[model samples]
Target: MEEEKYIGYIKYEGNLVEDGLMDARKQAQALLGFDSALRHFIGKRAPDFRNLDFEIPVRIRKGSWEALIPETVGGWVQGGLGIVATAYFTKAAQKMAEKDFSDFGITDLFKHAISAIQWFVRIGKHMGDTAIRSFENVQFLEGNTLVAIPNDSGEYLYVPKKMLDLYTSCNPKILEKIAENIEEGRELTIGTIVNGKVEEVAIYAEEKGIFCEEEAEPEEDVLFPELVHGDDVVLEGEVTRENKTSNSMGFKYEEHILTAYPESGSVVRYKPLLFLKCRLYGTVSRLDEKGSIAARRPKLYVSHLEPLESDREEDDLFR
Candidate 1:
């Protein structure tokens, strides 16, 4: 292995107001004897970039907001009453980028500013109480006993091995050995840390202890019928209604369409409340002993169609 060598770069933010104000006060005496237009120009014209010296040299570091100036100026800073102030403030940044490229040979301005601008936005949001809210909710089911706790602040520090061990201790009836049968599943809930970051796992029964199984490749199930026309075939909506003659339970869907099987489920949009126009596929699971639907209504099954020869040939070029 060879050692890598890298060059160091420094970003500068020059202070104009403090230095300019001091110089303006000194230059007022010289401006008094000039013509009215010159006097006004002298009073208003800000000094050039070369002359001003900044009191503070804010260093750009890992968590620094130095990178966010460009984005803010381009996005929110260009509008409203403070436009003049925003323009004046960001001018230094524009000049600084030019100076950086000339002096340090850095060519890409956008890439360099991205990290800084993101940090600045993050800090601004955090300071203004707009930080994103993430909950740490957990539901642990050991045998038959179910324990659910809401973690709003992400402070669930202790997850004992014993908690997992109790799965076999209680020997719940509904518990299945999903790990043994299924190759891969994540048992841990979303947002919870497994080994510093979030991990996936599943819950099932064991002889003496409940255990976590790492993710594994899942076995694919073969669907009947090679190809169907249109994008509806691709969506593969959930099967809600099974093939059945009469529906005793009141289902409040706007329109119900019957399929070959009565107990098959209905396919709605991805979100239940959203009413986007999409197709729903349906199929019926076999009925239970009581003649009631063993599975719920609107059970949609997506039929996977094999591609035509032309489609496959066309895809090869893109791939």
Candidate 2:
């Protein structure tokens, strides 16, 4: 696998109030000053990219403020309020003409950038002169989840395994930490990179000394016309045409033809059952696609094999 790289920028928008005073241009300039400090910090910390230059061009308009990030350093602006931030991938990050760097990984870089800024803010708070305001919206751009789907071309689109790893690992950790450490008068917005864009997933806010938010339920009417890659489905059917093989890596894999009986009709699908420790009569999520001559019949990379309740007999029934 090739190493993926990215160019990250943290855009901060807000006002600087000194002695209950607010000046648009002055606030923008203050942010520009902080940008200088940010550059220095990035130079001292991320020595690997010391050559990267950052431009902090300040823009001021009617109730509109913008600060450009030109260097690699992440720093805090004294008397500045954060509204939003975004990061874009550099040319160096692209691996191939078709393949882009993983969004999950870019989000990781964004978190690191924010942490660097927060560190600077904490230090300034100790000095009692700098006050950093929390951002209402924070996002890392150029983030995406790579998904594969079959088209007319008899080739398979492969979702990189690393993408899945990053999504499953990073999301939960970030959410848990935010939920545990969220302070009073602050809110945290959570989102994921979906199809090359940042999609807001959830928000955590402090209310009545507790973080409470409504959970989003999956849409019931959202059904795919054809089974595509990365579709979560429940397959309750009989296993047929089963086969097993071992790869050069000595990994044993299994595949079987599943015939499912839905209320509308019966559908036949080929799926993989990799080291599943249960009987196959439950829900599974599609992972990858293996194109076939029959466009409708594609091999599926599936996981999360959950056995049906009927398949699990109680102690009395077993006896």
User: What local distance difference test score does each model get?
Assistant: 0.25, 0.30
Count clashes in each candidate, considering only residues at least 3 apart in sequence or on different chains.
47, 5
Candidate 2 lDDT, 133-183, residue by residue in tens: 222222323354443323222333333333323322221222232233233
Residue 20, model 1, lDDT: 22
TM-score of 2: 0.22
The digit string of per-residue lDDT tens for model 1 on 1-319 reads: 9532111112211232222232333233212211121212212223331232211111222321111112122232224324553555466456766553332111122222222222222222222111212223555555534443332223342232232232222222111222122111212110112123432222212110112122232322422223221223232222222111222111112343212221333321111211122333333333335765442222223332122233233322211
Candidate 2 minimal-lDDT segment of 10 residues: 244-253
Off by over 4 Å in 2: 1-28, 54-111, 126-319
In angstroms, how far off is 303's CA in candidate 1? 3.2
